[model samples]
Target chain A: MVSLKQLDLTDLSVRQVNEYLHGELLEERPAGVEILNPDGLHSIAAGLDTEVEIDILGHAGYFIAGMNQRARVTIHGNVGWSVAENMMSGVVRVKGHASECAGASGHGGLLVIEGDASSRCGISLKGTEIVVGGSVGHFSAFMAQAGTLVVCGDAGPNLGDSLYEATIYVRGSIHSFGADAQEEEMQADDFEKVAELLSRAEMNYDAREFKRVSSARSLYHWNADAHQEY
Target chain B: MCGIVGLLARRSDYRDDLGKLVTPMLDCMATRGPDSAGLALFRSPLETTSRRFALYAANIEYDWQSLADRCQRELDTQASLTFVENHAALVSPVAVNTFKAWLKKTAPEVHLLSVGQSIEIYKDEGHPEEIARRFHFSEMAGTHAVGHTRMATESAVSPAHAHPFTAGEDFCLVHNGSLSNPYSVRRKLESLGIAFETDNDTEAGCRFLEWRMREGDTLETAIEVAQAELDGFYTFLMATADKMVLVRDAFACKPAVVAETDDYVAVSSEFRSLAHLPDIKHAHVYEPAPEQIYSWSV
Candidate 1:
């Protein structure tokens, strides 16, 4: 297993560090790579395709682990923009707050933000599972495709705008739905699924306390012509 | 700096009259970039091999002939020098590897932009349709093609500064946005004594592709590296002889949409350009993911 010491970044540029993490040291990163100072370095561990594990000690920057194929990245500090953006597969754990577009256009995999998540948290999420422990910013889950987003705290304005096929669950109040999304009663099966996902991420939560939100069956379906006004 | 459009036949499924089908599509992206325009077409009626290269310079200088000559000599085995012009050429029996190796040994400071099969470029400054008329871009045809419209930010306005910038024989690129940091990268490219033709970020992009390909990166990987390292907002498209690659910036500040059918795929800066397709009603249209790459093969 590749065991990168945190001190190894003394001389390497951000690109070099990413190249080493995603390119050369990927296969050997079974034991995981430990980053000492992950302070705002954009594109860290991006596009990784191995089953490697990366531990960032501090805040990270935009598009970190973008297009991730099969890597597990954990951030200890707050992350800037687009954490795990456009992820194809794999897992990303943000211990602190997350900025805008947290999982934008993700096709698959799971994202867990332990703290507050900013606006457009799961914008255009395509088959991704996102769980935010704290509140979220405006337009969260905008234009989401097919996936599941779970927010433990309050959601901001225009939640689930232009939502496609994704499902959302929130323990706190939502300002409003953007287009056709609406709140629904949580079912037994949905509670079970949410509980399982939260358990997998080891988050402290009870699925029973949350309500489910989803499309009103109005937009994007082949024959559904009824449009919902903002 | 430019807009690029192309047709990549899933199974050579584009219309029999490919040229006739491509002209109007290329004409749509005029506002994005409009400095100068050109088109390169290739066909394999019997057995044809194509190679595409996108080169980036480490630095901007007055001359690139030595680098070009080195490229010509290094890639002699794969290319027969079918045609030569100010920036690029058309070669028969395009050699992908030979060109790649030459890039590594010679233009290590440059970036290898792209590598693939058949390439056609339509570039100029003006509205897309206006540039098309000026270049007579409709005359060229291929199963796969890429076009660019320029809104110059860093480079001087000229055909040389235009998009669909070529690296070797068959690769070209069209870009939008600026590279925030060009000094260090340009210095490195010039360290190899590589000369540059234009003062545009797009040229730097071409050099970067060349540099990456030389480093043994696939055209796709090279372009990805460019997207990662280069700074600022970028929503650009690239075409090689064999494939088309698109990259959006970190936040995807710019807009790009992709419409795909079983038989066709179209990309544009806005959705309106795609609304004109015959199968537009049936195709699935979506915006490309930010900081992502979408590829199509010819």
Candidate 2:
């Protein structure tokens, strides 16, 4: 049986909570942790290196669980901007909507948003797999280098602008696709991959409705012949 | 970067604590904007059928009594004045335009912060908490209020450049994000005889709305027209005597969240700002769609 440690952020300052989470907790390596009454505090549980299970009871502010190496974090309420930003490994889940720049520039991780995410989700994602259950705001996956972004709902405008290499799956309507981003037919392998991602995120959604988007590869090298496309 | 917050109470019981509640919301977004702060409050109109103007002077010790006396003598009507810090609230039975003309001729240096039946605006170049303290915000009681904390990007930092720019009578606007083509817009409006106070981009947007409203367009129509005319990323919170409106650009780059309950409608740049509101845990919170105007009327 795993022991559970409890922490409350009602009175502690954001700096104090971040310091404790990044310093002592990383060294002690608690099996499970619960943060009660988060109340929209910022930078909570950021830069965690331990493989521990953590749960936040209330709303969290910006950069919650950012730069995680190995940690399974679950936020029971909504989150502010840049949740799970630049994660290396492990899973971060939000039961409610997440604000802008969620999972931005993450190299490796699984980010699951149970509700809608605001603008700039999964921007510059590298090897991270993000699953959003609801609609995403504009400028999502802008300049993404690599990885996969799966949206179960509608996607906002300018999706995947200036992409190098990334696989995007959307089950609903897309407002507009960004430059160099084109819709591709979802193959049998693509469906299997999306099914695995949804199963990993613990979300129940029909995989057949998903559409695949990838880079057109037209802007890979500048050519005067393709000037009209540019 | 800038932070904006607006709160309108549907119930009169929450009026007394409006300032106290909104001040904290403004203070929480201090990191987004640290240079200057401003607020516009709408209190219940006085029992008398008089128009009110809130005036601010750079020198805190400027004599406001003489101005009131001048207005009373020249306009042939009773004028009442009340002082709070460097601001004075004056009420007169004269029309707003006539009173404003008289004021411009008499006290050219005294700035009119706002002129309306119930609106009072106070702003200065400083931290939000300092500005709130200087204005004694805790003692104010109102039905609705809007505030802005500005981090100057294109304009110089001063009280005049601070936000909550008045458009017409009781209409004011607070903006986050920059306008791409304000100079061209300013030139067009200037050609139409719309006088401008500051070179700030937000002023151009406000004056555009004022011009549209003057041309018989409703606030909703003006906003829709603005969407087609204005370029750049912006989230605007506008307030009239009876309504509060919120609009975001089509790109939706700048953040805005709204929480509504049976008693109040609250808007802020982030959820952290609205976390402390009464009954927020059960409040219906959602982000407004891009380019869609969300409004509430009293």
Candidate 3:
């Protein structure tokens, strides 16, 4: 059986809550922890390094669960900007929609958004796999260095701009693709990768309908003749 | 960074709570922008024949009553002025253009913030809560409203730099990003005989829309043209007498979220601004597409 702990945010300030979660209190590493009444305040559960599960009961504000390591942080309601930014490992799930820069610049982790994600989702991602069950706004996966991003719904304009080694999979329409990001054929192996991602995110969708987007490789090497294309 | 919020009531029951609802939304984004705050409220027109115009005074003790009395005697129409802090709203039984011409000739010092049948604009350089408290926004009622909190990326922090810049009668706009080519755009509009009140890029964009509308373009066409011409990262929340318009640039660097329910429609720079709105949980929340104009009319 897993151990459970509860922290009520209404009675505590954000700093106090963060201090308690970051200090020796969580050193025992409870299996699951519950945070109540977040009320959309900012910086909840930020910079957490524990390998425990944290469940935020209500809406969260900006930078929630940012720079995480080996912890599963879940928000039951909507999330504000940069949810799970620069996470090194583990999972961060938002049950509702996310605002801008969701899962931005993460080095390693699986960030699952059950609902739509706003603009700049997974911006400058580095080795993080972001799976969105719904659509994503513009500039998703912008200048991503590595990892994979799967959008089950439509992607807004300028998806995967200046992409570097990162892969994008979209099941629905794409408004427009950014520079150096182009469509690629989804082979059988690509389907397997997308299937594994969907199962890991616990979302149900048809992977066969997804289109793959990756860098054109033309921008990696600088050539004087290619200046106009840039 | 800046924050913009707009609320339009789809039902009559929500009209009375417009200001009350928008105040909290503006306050939620207080941290994003700390330089200044402003709002444009659209109340229902009174039963009388007078049109409403909101004016700004250079000082708090400006003689607004004398101006009203003089305008009433000279224009030969019933006129009234209600003072609020450094601003006042004038109601007069005269044509808008005629009244504006008279004011320009007589009271050169007074600045016209807005002139319409229902719109009243209040803005100042301060915290969002302080500005709202001084204007008594929580006690006012309206059918629709737009609020802006400024971070002052492009201009000096002053009352003239506050947002919800009026373009045409009952039309105003609030923006949340900087423009790269506002001076050239301003020059182009100036050559077309459009006057500017401030050097802010948002005012240039607002006047561009007004100029396009005057050239026989619809609001949608004007926005589409703006998308092709304006070079910047912006998320704009614009309002007319009966409609609210939302637009993001092609890159969509600036954020905008919209929530719609059976009773009302609200748009904000972030979801936190809309989190406390009534019936928001059940509402359909989504982010608007880049360069696509999303508008709703009552």
**Local distance difference test values of all predictions, in order:** 0.69, 0.89, 0.89
The candidate 1 chain A region of ten consecutive residues with least summed lDDT is A221-230
- State the lDDT of candidate 3 residue by residue for B63-171, as single tens digits: 8889999999999998888888788999887998888899999998888899888899999889999999988888778989999999998899999899989977888
Q: What is the lDDT of residue A230 in candidate 3?
A: 67
Worst 10 residues of 1 chain B by lDDT: B81-90
Model 2, A1-230: lDDT tens digits are 43777787777776776676777776676678889878777888898887889999988888999998889999998998899999999999999999889999999989999999988899999888999999888889988888899999999999988887878999999999999899999899999999999999987987898999999988888788875675
All candidates: TM-score: 0.48, 0.96, 0.93
lDDT tens per residue, model 1, B80-181: 332122233334354566566666787666544334454434343446676566545555446666666666667677655766666654666666677777
Instruction: Report the poorest 10 consecutive residues by lDDT, candidate 2 chain B.
Output: B43-52
RMSD of 3: 2.4
The sequence of per-residue lDDT tens digits that candidate 2 reaches over residues B20-59 is 8888888887778899999999988767778788898888
TM-score of 1: 0.48
Listed in order, the DockQ scores are 0.02, 0.66, 0.48
